[model samples]
Target: MKIVVVSDTHIPKRAQRLPSRLLHELRSADQIIHAGDWQSLEVYEQLKQYAPVNGVFGNTDNEDIIRVFPDKKIVNVNGFKIGIIHGHGKKMTTVKRAFTAFNQPIDCIVFGHSHIPYLKYKNKTLMFNPGSATDKRKAPFYSFGILTMSDELHAQHIFFKSK
Candidate 1:
């Protein structure tokens, strides 16, 4: 399965629309996952038009978004257990908090809150943060991610200059 991963869109607050490059990926993805901070349901609605979307709600999300998405979730894709969370909390680093969110074993943890793209493995679990598609914050470039799963899992970050 081909999955397009993104987070912290903050639409209308960050950018008016998703970058064309990301839209193209979403159009071709078998599934789409947003880590959080969508800001509005319109973002979700827009993404759903292209592919199935699995995601959580971030701190900035209102009741409308929180009503549809949880603060954390686990999804099974092609025999791989993936944990999805919007890593926002009062204490501890986002990555540290993500590791503690799930009690069960998970092959990968996908999170977003800091708007910093990250990919690493710790304690044998893959940690992926797609950063922000519409909001780069202080980052040099806007970015997103893609995950391809078959016999194995492959994840990559795609960076660009535009929102």
Candidate 2:
């Protein structure tokens, strides 16, 4: 499976549209997973054009988005369980918060907020933050994530200087 992961696309608040690089990657996606902070449902609609879309709602999302998604969720793709969350909280690091969001076993965790691309293993679970496709913040470039699965699940970040 080819999973295109993205988050913190603050939409018109950040970039006027999804980055071309991200859209390009989406073309080959078997599925798309969005972590959160999507400012508009139009973004969701656009993504669905490429593949099946699944996501968790973020702190910045309004009721409209929240109504369509959950604050946190777990999805099973190709027999691997993946936890999804938008890492925004009053205390603790975003990574720590995401790690604790799920009580059951999962193969990976996908989160956004703080807009920093990260790919690391926590015990057996791979934690991934695709960063901000639209808002890179202090980061050098805009970024997103891709996960490919066959015998095992592998994840990596796709970074670009322009969004």
Candidate 3:
């Protein structure tokens, strides 16, 4: 299965739309996961065009988003257990979040909030962050991620140069 992971879009505050590169990546993905801080329903709607999307509300999101999205969730894909969260607590880093989720029977943890794209392996679980799709503060950057699942699951972060 191919899963696209993204987060912290912040939308109008960062860019006018999702980068074309991200859209292209999503088009080929089997599923989509948005970590949070979407900032608008339009973002969610836009993502839906690429693939089926599941997401949670970030600290910056409004009540409507909170009501619509769960704070955390678990998805079973092709026999692999995947956990998703926005990572807003004190231990917000990927490693920390992965460790916290280690208690669960999950094979991977996907999260975002700091707007930095990263992939790490903790013990047996893969941890991933898709960065900010709106290029919030770091460089003229935006990105999305792809999780490749087979016998061994792997994560690849794809960056988008802001246009």
What ordering of candidates by lDDT runs from best to worst? 1, 2, 3
TM-score of each: 0.98, 0.98, 0.90
Off by over 4 Å in 1: none
- Model 3 lDDT tens row, 23-110: 7787788899988898888998888887899888888899878888988888888899888888887755555864585467778888
How do the residues 1-163 of candidate 2 rate in per-residue lDDT, one tens digit apiece? Answer: 9999999999878888998999999999999999999988888999999999999889888888998999999999889999999989978999999998899998999999879999999988899999988898899999999999988999999999998
Estimate the Cα RMSD of every predicted model relative to the unseen true structure.
Answer: 0.6, 0.7, 1.9
Q: Where's the lowest-lDDT run of ten residues in candidate 3?
A: 90-99
Cα distance off (Å), candidate 1, residue 141: 0.7
Model 2, stretches more than 4 Å misplaced?
Answer: none
Model 2 earns a TM-score of 0.98
Candidate maximizing lDDT: 1
Model 2, 149: alpha-carbon shift in Å? 0.5
Q: List the residue pairs that clash in candidate 3.
A: none
The better-scoring model by TM-score among 1 and 3 is 1
State model 2's lDDT: 0.93
